[model samples]
Target chain A: MSAPEELTVDVNGFQTRVWRKGSGPVLGFIAGYGGLPRWVPFLDHLAERRTVIVPSLPGFPGGERGHTVLDSHLDWIVAVRTLMEKSGLVGADLAGSSVGASMAAEMAAVWPADVRRLALIAPLGLYDETDPPADPWAQRADDVPGLMCADPEVWKALKAPPEGANSIEWPIEQVRANEAAARIFWPMGNTQLAKRLPRIAAPTLLLWGEHDRVMPRSYAARIGALLGGRHETRVIGGAGHLAELDRPREAADAILSWTS
Target chain B: MKLMWFHLMPYTELPDDFRQRHPSVWVDIHSELFDPKRAHLMYNDFMDELEYAADCGFDAICVNEHHSNGYGLMPSPNLIASSLARRTTNTALCVMGNSLALYNPPTRVAEEFAMIDVISGGRLIAGFPVGTPMDTCYAYGQNPSMLRQRYLEAHDLVMRAWQEKETFAFNGRFNQQRYVNIWPRPIQQPHPPVWVPGGGSVETWRWCAEMEYVYCYLSYYGYKAGRATMDGFWNEMARLGKDRNPYRAGFLQFVGVGESRQHALDLYSEAAEYFYGRCLHVDPKWATPPGYTSEGSQRAGIESQVKQAADSIVRGKSTGERMAATARDMKGIVDNGYVIIGSPDEVAEQLREVAVTLNVGHLMLLLQFGNMNKEVCRFNTKLFADKVKPLLSGLFSEWEDRWWPKPMEDNLRAEIPAFLPKLAAE
Candidate 1:
């Protein structure tokens, strides 16, 4: 089983990058900020059993920047919808990491017609007044591995600093923009997601890193509790915020099992 | 008693519309603020803030590290310390510091501390922390089982780099270098004073005692909460045949002041709520990760929080209720010996009591609480310096001469590598 040809589509006035592979129910992937664009490698191991679809998000690496002030959730949802229509995708499994997980949750909540199953790996968006806030930009790019895994050596191995095309580059600007975005949404991100969790009709699986310093696994329970649909929470041992990067085999297996 | 002020530079206000379109505003609170350009500006402002603290009569201004998180905006405490080294006159630059075990060579810390000490004219307190399980074992991907060992090794390596004068070869299980040499040696003889900050870990106490380092318990929960842990430390110190001399130990407390206790409590209640409720909310999985915290420490922290939550339920306490209900008992935790929050008179009186009770010489005041407005923090800081410091200065001035390290000749020292015998033979 091999990946399909790379496909390009216009989504919300942005040139979006999309790729498909294998021949089963379509599985859409939403990546966290700074994630590699080549989703084929990530899905290559799973392509044997199912088909997968991954799109490069706007303003992210390899994707065109859309509106500067547009809502990220809406932009992503619309982009995924546009990609699905262009690629002739019907019902598919959905998976996302970090910010991507929030988008995946939103997609399942608002457009249940497009998703049959969903998996969120160390997903974000669940903010309680009692939990610590995750600041993606405050960290040195090299320090990310540490933030995402339980084993320092593993994090050290993954410590490829974001650079050139792959790098977000303007960290301070990104941080300020994020802070502004957070204030604008107030509690909507939390309240809306909590409200829409009940609307997610598809089977859902929540994967969390046991050592996730960013969005601690405690948020996993809140995520599971809010999503009124059938949901299971799996905590990946020795993983951090970026569970897939930290413990790929375990994360991939969890996703494959849920989708299958 | 030496007084240190702790500040966590947090981006308090977020732009309005940014929160809406973002997928997860909760997690991304400070990401946008950390953009390269903004980070440069924030760093400058943060440095200025710390410099201001120095000018306000603080003995030392502290900074620490956190990543991909808004709680403590400093990812590189060294950067801030470096800046403070040039900007401040007398205040010591406490890097409270780089997680030694997280660095590959650990000598990077040695070199950096040496550089900062020279830059700051011999005013530097080198802090070597094992780091929290969340920080070390999880964030840095260190083996939790070997975290303590790794930390100790790193500590030794850095210390050797500072104390030894000659370039040498070295090898170790975690760090290996053909030639070991650190430039720009520290001005403080035998290196600046070493301080160890712990979150009530048993291993940390023994290590501090063995090393004869100042053991600073950064009590976030408050004083009463750390009683058992402090008692355990004292017992260990006794076992090591160390005296109950207060100069050998210190504790950190969060203090807030206003015109009256009612005003102080009301003004600080929101910040406290933010700190405990929003800032410290750790998922049970992350908080009690498998093998992250020791069985005993984990059990104790959980039990304490649970008991506090249960007590809150029975008593109908609104303050700290939302956050406390989820975890351990925090009541009197700070009061027991960790924190003192009130008006100047009240906080000073409590400090005197805590110093007497703990029989300690140093008090690290976390003057800045979660998202506390700058104006308020400045006011609180001024009040403490004016009213509180005067009350306690007399108590410890005489002992300073007896216990504190005397001024030493400012000069570069030799460096020592891991394999001293091999280098000597060569």
Candidate 2:
């Protein structure tokens, strides 16, 4: 019902802002390319029974100001692992979307003992030559909203420029986030996570939206199979890449059923 | 004033429907659009134009680096600079310059520049650019956030390598070398004078000012579009208590010279259209990769102003309204000061105004642009050299240009005759 309180946390050397709420079992959520928008009803729904922690990935809007020199995906996994450990998130449930989803899988594979459950929404790092994912960096700024969401209203709402911010401040914020995303996912998002997908001992949940054109269903299926046993796949209807924002009820129900 | 003839060496023969069918002229544009047969002639002619400019008595001839683009065919400017060093004898070599961060050790840049300096008998004005986002971030797949950091580190390494006489170890964030020695040190003491070419970034203005390096504004939009940027640099220089010597800055402008103003316009209108319409049809997305603008720069709000100004000009709107690049006709280009098309006197007068207004002592002339043929390019270069240059050469004679090449005096500046005269004896 209320907006989550924001907390600034320093992991190792870098710092990031995290949004947290609820009081039950700890759950860590890594943001996607569009980042954690102002509103997310599913975050509230999940917060009903579980404590949720969302850290802004570096280079995005509210993340640490000056740390974008990640040499490889392994460096990113190590950084995220350090953050989780620093945040006291031992054996907790971890969820990620898009670039974040791929990072979550990496954390699960690399530090299995620290993560009990893994949930990926429109996850990346899995490449399908026949059915490849859309490049967020290549798409025109005007075409971004439509490509991101299936619903026209949501698309229109997202495309509208922010109010109160000056012209320079507006694009500056967007470019910062985009720069961070590009650093991690440019050229291609594949970190060869498929090789380590089977190493993820935690129970995995793969969620894909029916209208999610960016990361198609083929990727979800491939990730599901690569993850081997103790994994489940759920396809949500009438939603795009951001199922939690589009069909929050359906997304919440799936997460609740699995975690409960 | 010091005059340098700069060439983008554009792939001039793009299909008429290139803008309509292609998403961009850079980065991801299909390679099928490029035909090697056509490129053979273009490259040779481009080189001929640069050589002809040198022969026409231009003080320096310039070349630069770009990648995977139809706009500039010189991915490795050193190759062209090297070839030009052999062909020309007197003119200073302004290799304005190689992309430092792209090299692995970055000593490669130092070594190549040293070789060029040695070959040219010490005539090399080294230009260190952060490079455009499309070149570094997308085409080369460098991380946008770390690119500047990498560039800075590479710069430190390159400068130190060129200056240090003895072998030393360099442990940098981007590169680590056990033996940091480079052979064939530059002829210019403590290395050649460094010139930094940048699009209007506030950070660059500050950096160039602090380093005391010549700050060059290389915008395709020309003198009018560059007013704010040049003003910002001068203001920064004053803030730092640096001298207001006009020699501290260089500005690039498109120039077309003919027998008369009307004839000049008629000669260059199609060429200007080809350049503005097709050569610069870059997708906005490719141009600005996120994090390309640093958080500090973004916060400072300078990048925004530059972007807005550029966008307005592109849209043909009079936002800041000084010079609209979106007014994409020959007349608009001429009127907006994007291109100076006129007779010798008319062109010289406008150039004098530009020099005085911008306070630039080193002026880089883009005389041959777009699809202008070899004959036209040579004619433009010669006319400017013979007519316009002499008038404006005395404008900034008060200040010394420390950024210019210090070529050996003993070596004769061997001049090639413009054309052989027929024998008079019968």
Candidate 3:
């Protein structure tokens, strides 16, 4: 098992970090809040067959500068589409989790021809007043990891600072990553994303964690019903909102088998 | 030296076990805990206290905004300032002030502030605060990432609205108005002096220095804890080649004056304990939103106290343990410089040193804090005015108070008829 390679590609002067691994069909992955500090078991499993291209969601971690420029959801959609083009992930199978998933869905809907097969894992951007998504933004820094994964300690270990990292810059960058995502999906995750969901023409897979607390299993049907193309739902057992982080192999298989 | 009376107007009747039972005192505090019936009396009492402070010879009376907060109830300080404008003739009405970003179109702030200035005969010290993360981000549902951008843009619009005489088409990223004409313009030329209340953000010091506004530090912890932030402001002033006009700065302190040192402790211990222990019982989540503090200030360790408070919560430091550490007893409270309590002579001497050392012309004192009854608040107000104020008056007499409000002269002021009978048409 080779370690994933890190590369920084400039997009319209904004430096975006993209992680590259494995080989086959290209699969672009975007992780959730505080973005991915590093690749998880999820990306590694997906990379077993596919050439995984995981771009840090703009303004998140490696894409820190995007926070200043991105504004509305339209701004986010354009930024992600351009980032995909610049990272050489254009026309690749797309998969996004949580906030990244929200951005992925937006890209597919706005620029339908750019994405091949789309996989969304408990994505946000839809708000139902009656049974609204549990707020992911208003969380304490320490409790955030626990909310994202079934086994909090597993994700916590992955997010813990690596050796030789500057202590002050480390926590600041971590918080700033959230700040970046927050600019796009702050206050409420909804940006009338429901209105545009019907425009997504790509074959879609709606992957959900059975025990997902953030978006919940109930939201799958609401999300699926609006899709314009062929779509199906899969539930990963013993997983939270981020099924990939909790049950990586199962999640990877879920995306691979469906798209294949 | 100018002394300003500031009231935090906390809900005095939170159940004795509030910090124990409630998860927080702000943002998401149980609404059922609030007693509106009690609030009716509290509001009137608070208003009376401000008016009384005005009569007591404090140079200014201040009120500020906070949303869904326990300790500070003035969600709309402009409303309070309007009432004070009519009631108090001599004192400056410092509505320190509307959260710039929260106002939609932000010209609303300009219009309302102008009205207050007109009604108050031009005695308005405008305040532009970035507001706390809890107030702006959670309670008011503002995006923390965009909050500073929105605040700066809103400020530009407000300043232009106040100064621009011609109807202008104002276009900005956060706000847009086709006709930016504010009626009932301020009597003061250019505008009322601006005061920026800070929580030690490094950027605020630079902004205040550049704008020539008073940088007021509103701290729950007293002067000892504030020296670093004040020094940071002075350093920025020097770098910008601005004069050390002590009037360019303001500092808030929690003070208690009694017949003796022991009597002062006995007089204020409960209120001080309530303020420090209960009013500050915020949920850690609401304290520091991501991007709420700038990277520079966060790196400079200016926002470290807020982070430390959050860290204490994460450690599951029980309320008993936390309270026992700081404001559990009066001795701990006074020692930590959270409150300055002593006889009039002692308090006067202490405050004189605070003004001189901090180089602040405006001394905003929190006389009415926590659930303190009106009687004790008035007692403190009267004692400070009679004994303490005189001692500090000579401290900054040399410096010009460039930031104080400039009211119109008596002969130049507007005069309506003393009484008007009912209209014949009515």
Candidate 4:
């Protein structure tokens, strides 16, 4: 697998960066907090059959400047719509992780026509009063990777410093991304997406990690019931909140098989 | 130079294991810890101390707003200021001040401040603070990103409402009022001398310098911790081509005065320990929500010791290490200048140095802090007012303090009658 080409797409006059790869149908992938890392082998694996489109969420690493104007989750949804429209992703497959998963769910709900199908991995929009999702923002930086993944190796790999010699850039990017995320999901991540979930008409897939520390298994039931239209559920046994990173091959295979 | 007495009115009776047991003293700290009966006595005693400060020839008495906190009991400084306005004669009522953004219609600030000013016979120094993250973002659930914008808009609206003679409309980003007229405008011609209390944000320094308002650094960490911030403020002022008038800045210092240096140390140690150790054991996360500090300020790396302490906590350092880093111990707190405790002459000398070093004309002294009893607070107030105040009063005599309250007259400094001298001679 070859490295993906990084490109910038203008959405509503804001410059957003997207990593483009592969040759077939468009699969728009939204990123979680801290934006997407420079290296993700999973994107290369998925790119063999389908063209994977990974856009940095407005306030994340590569797109920090562009995301400043987006303050609310609604603004984020608008930006995602713009991303789809500008990227020529009409009726394309959509997928996201954690905060990104919440965004994907929102886009599918609000503009069902724009997304042909939706895959949400450990989404964060709906809240269960009895067992709320672990707050990523409140967790210590050292404790973050462990919360994101059950596998210690995966956690260590994810936490490895940015490859660039500029050591400060990585943490700075994290701060920018965290600040951006806080704008939308600070005190709590609930965007009242439960009320709007019934509006989604597209086929949906809800994926959960059994050992997910951030978003527990209890969330699958809540999200599954709230989502509208034909849907399927999958629980990856050994993964954590970020199941894709922990079980990349399984996550990608599930996504590909579902899309096919 | 003007001397003001400030009180946090701390609820000083937290358990010894509060640091171990409670998550924080502010924001998420449990409500059951606050006892109403204790609060009642605290308020009465606190008010009596403020009244005493007024009687003892202080220029002003200061109160500020904090929410969901064991430390700093005043959620509404304006209410306390209102109560103080009637009881004290001639002392400027410095409600430093109502948090503008928290109010639905910020004109409530204008109206209430005006009311206090009128009641105090034109002695109102209006203080506008953007407020702490614990108070504004976490406790109030305000969007950290929009907080500053909202604060700026509210400040503008309040200023216009106070100044504009005609009943006009205010179309603000955060607030909209068709008929923007506040009843009972302040006694001072233009709005009261507006002082902005800040915690070393570069933007705040620029804003204060730009607006020509007094940049009051409410440093709970004391003069040593505040040197960099105050210097930065001066440098910003210089950069903006503003005058280096000492009165344009104010610094908050916690001072304990006694008959001797050792005596002062003995008297204030327990109270200082309670304050530095117990009252400030806040959860690191509660202290800083992202976007609360501006990117510019964050990059500038301007912060207080409290924020640094919170950072250490978040990094998950051992308790002893974190406490050491926070200067929670009596020795560290005193050595770091968090509290200045000494004999009258010693405290006065140190304060003079602080005034000269910070180049501040207004010295707002926290004579009462932590769990210090009412009698001790009263003693500290009297000793400082009688001995320490006279030493520093003439330091900045040349510069005009435009921010000081415009009292109708100096009733407190009234002349002793001619007959009294004749009676004394007879």
Candidate 5:
């Protein structure tokens, strides 16, 4: 596989960063909470199969930050739809992880024509009060890695700033991503996406991390059941939330087989 | 040089091993630990102490807001301030005050504060604190990232509600209202003087300086630890070209006035221990939630707080140790200036220096703190009013206090307390 192409697009007045590579079919990917600051091995693996397009959710890692004030869930969803359209990923097979996964799944639900096939890895939209998921926002900064990943060291390694990037600005960008997410899903992670799940008509794949502490495997089963059309659950072992970062090869294969 | 009587109103009946058993005094502090019957007594005693302070001739009587905490019992400080408004006629009623973000519509705050001001005949120093992370974020579920934004929006809404004569539609990001028409308009023209109580937030001093509001530094760590925060405020004032009228800034300090140094220690030691050891026994996790402090504040030392807390976990530093709380003893408290304790003359001299050095005019003194009994709190209040206040009132007398509440009558402090503590024994 050749080098991934870095690009930028305007999403509803907000300038967002996008990355594209590989050939075949267009695979529009939305990144997880720990954003794709650098091209992770997972993206490299996924790129081997088909053309992959990943847009930085506004206020996420590479996205323009001063536009952190995305007011509500509707605003966020519309912004995601714009990202899909602007990145030329309309009608493409779509995938996302964690909060990104939630946005991807919502795109299929609310704007069904935007996403042809859906792959959501540990999506964080549906919140169960009886068996609540761990609040990623509430965790201590140092402890967050251990909470989200099977091995904390994997997260530390993934967070290394790409070459030619400001080492100081890298951490600041990550915090801005969190701040943006917190704006939409604060107090708790519930976006009431369960209400809109039945609207999704696309064939969906719910991939969950076996060791995921943030959103457990139970959430995937619930999400699979809630999705409108045919959907299946696949547990990627030796991983946690945002499984692609932890078990990139395994996560890539699961998505390629199910969605590609 | 206006002296204000402030009370934290800490719960009085935690067991001797409360800190050992409890993870924190805030947020997850067990509900079962609170006994309403005992709180009933504590509440009345605390109220009596404030009234006594008013009678003892403090310029202002103050109460503040906190939630789900063993440290501060006044979740609705407006309720306390409203009650104080009715009971005390002369002293300014300072509600240190409602956390603007926690209230919905923001007009709720404006309406309630107006009621307090009207009831007090315009003696209201409205404190607009963004609130601590434990209170606003955890207890009230205000998002740490948007807490300040919500607070600022609420501030704008509340100010507009007070100043706008006609009902107006408020369209805010966090809060909205179809019509904001507040009844019982504040007796003070436009609104009561705005006092923003801040702790380690860089944006607050800038905001306060821009708004020409009083920036009250309400740090529990006393005057020594308070210098940096106060200096930051003054520097911002100087840079902004705002006059350092002293009243433009307020400072809270734990104070104890006794016959001598030993007597002061004997009087305040247990309460200081209880306050520093138990009242501040916050779990490190609950202390600094992410996005609670801004980037500028993060640089200013909020990061150091989080870093210290993380190190505290590694070093297994107790709450007492984390705060450098002077080892929960009177001597350490004095050494750290966590509490000012000495004879009336000594305390007065030291406090005068604190006022001049920190350049703060509105001195909100914690004469009643921790689990001190009502009698002692009154004794401390009366002693400070009689001795310490007179000495310091002359320090900044040349500068006019523009931020004070212009009351209908400032004659409230003339009345003496029912009884003073017995000083001389046979």
Candidate 6:
């Protein structure tokens, strides 16, 4: 399955950049904050098996500005629904990364019939206020291999500015976004997601990076245990929070295999 | 010229009855002690101690990070630093740091460091450590072998993030972010001074020397074990053709003071034993786990320790016995230079010798060790500052001045642009 070539949708007050490709059962992808259009490589592979829809989230470069209030969960659901309807996707397999993962969980709870299956990679929204989230940007910025992959050389090759900025600015922006998100979802953004998980009817697969400093893999088991539906959780070895970037093939394979 | 007193607030003397009832009870010493109610008390006491240190003429006070361990009670050193920021007046709040590799993105460190630096009114010595294998590899799940690489990258990213004026992209192996921009930048223009702490790693020595960073050798074992490490560093500096600048080098030692050496020993022996036996036991596995320690570090640490121990045995010496005896003899352990426990005068004299011998510009005294009582730790700290510090300050001042001469204004000039950007008419 591959992502769609073009799928425009209104977000906040502007048209957002969304793409869809392939021709099978539709699969929608919602990316994390600051995530761009290029992160849809997995969708390209998934497109080989199914139709994929990917949206450039609001406030992200090349995407529409987010709402003034910027309720990420509500905005994400609206955007995904808008993309699905625009792309003629009645029902689709949904997946998201970071903040996007929270949206997927929300959608599964609120619009259960719309999503057939769920794939969440290092999902946010379950953070407990008492137990603080590990800020991966601060902890592992200097550690290229630690942040990206187990292999130093692999990290070196993939090393480039995140998307819109250069190496230095990327971390700063990431920190700001992380803090903003953390503030928005207090106590544990994902903890509430876990509570509402029983409402989800979709069979869910949770993918985590074993080296995920952002959302430590310690929470994976708890997240899996909470879902009432058939739930599977797998750790991608040698990968950090952005596991797809670190181990793209392995991440894609996990998703593809699961969907198949 | 700045002085900072550091203490790891450990539960030194658990009551005998408590121990009898709780032997091997897995008390979750770190979490339990920090559980809100107790944590508030402990933190308040620690803040008072630090404030006392400041009142006693110290320039700064320090705290550090550890995990799931009783050795150092601080799991989040920043929390301590933050609290100190509000309470402290003239003292610099030093957090040895949040281990870089254990973090994702690594910018969270940049942000927090910046925040703390600003909050402390530029009174921040941002300490970065690659971290010990036991802490880094076991607790944080970082591969020790790749620890250095991760640390280096994290350092580079944070530095760039701090210094860069414009929004930029950071595409690195580990961190990928677009629109790199940070608010509330550090109060210091080019960020704060960076201090790297190590325990006698050759790689650390070379890197510190190369980077011209303040290399702090935490001499937990005392001066004897630290002698070779400091010598190795000076030798490396010599080979690099850099003058032996004392300001670039620092040493940390554990100190306990009393009316006499025997009194000090009596007071600290049990706590020292707990530190060495219970807290310091590296679980061999955590110390040198598979794919944890780097090949270079492995060669220097485990492999070298093994070879040296083997050599001692081959020479028909009492190798095992010597090793075991060294482990048991707390005073010999300190005198041999792992720790330094004595009266104020004795500790002062010892520190002076260490500074002169090692040509160390900075001396970081761990006033608290093992589970030493908080009151005892505070008293020792006051005694050292009041009695000991004044005696040695003048002895090293001339050396410090000679080696670290103030920078000439011309030499310190900034490369400002001649042309300024014009603003559009509002």
Best by lDDT: 3
TM-score of chain B of 3: 0.92
In terms of TM-score, how similar is model 6 to the real structure?
0.55
Give Cα-based local distance difference scores for all models: 0.64, 0.79, 0.82, 0.81, 0.81, 0.64
| Candidate 1 chain B lDDT trough over 10 residues, lowest sum | B312-321
What tens-digit string does per-residue lDDT give for candidate 2 at A143-166?
A: 777677777567556434667756
Per-candidate DockQ values are: 0.02, 0.62, 0.63, 0.37, 0.42, 0.02
Q: What share of the true interface contacts does candidate 1 keep?
A: 0.00
Q: Model 2, clash count?
A: 2
TM-score of each: 0.54, 0.92, 0.94, 0.92, 0.92, 0.55
Instruction: Predict model 4's lDDT versus the native.
Output: 0.81
Residue pairs with colliding backbones in model 3 are none
Q: Best DockQ goes to which candidate?
A: 3
Q: Candidate 4 residues B1-426, lDDT tens each?
A: 889999998997899999999878887788888899989999999988898888888999999999988888999998899888877777888889877889888988999999988878889999998888778887888877778888999999989988999999988766888998899998887989999998766788888888989989886778886787788789889998999899999999999999998899899999998988888787775645666667665544423223563222212122212333468778888998999989989998999999999999998999999999988998999889889888888988888887787776666433423321211232
Candidate 1 per-residue lDDT, tens place, A82-149, comes to 66667555577889887678767777888886788899987666667688546543343455456656
**Chain A TM-score, cand. 4:** 0.94
Every candidate's TM-score, chain A alone: 0.79, 0.92, 0.95, 0.94, 0.95, 0.77
TM-score of 4: 0.92
RMSD each, Å:
19.1, 3.7, 4.5, 4.8, 4.1, 15.9
Model 5 C-alpha RMSD to native: 4.1
Residue pairs whose backbone atoms clash in candidate 5: B90-B412
Model 3 stretches with alpha carbons more than 4 Å out: B302-326, B415-426
Off by over 4 Å in 4: A151-161, A165-169, B302-324, B409-426
Instruction: State which candidate has the highest TM-score.
Output: 3
TM-score of chain B of each: 0.81, 0.92, 0.92, 0.91, 0.91, 0.82
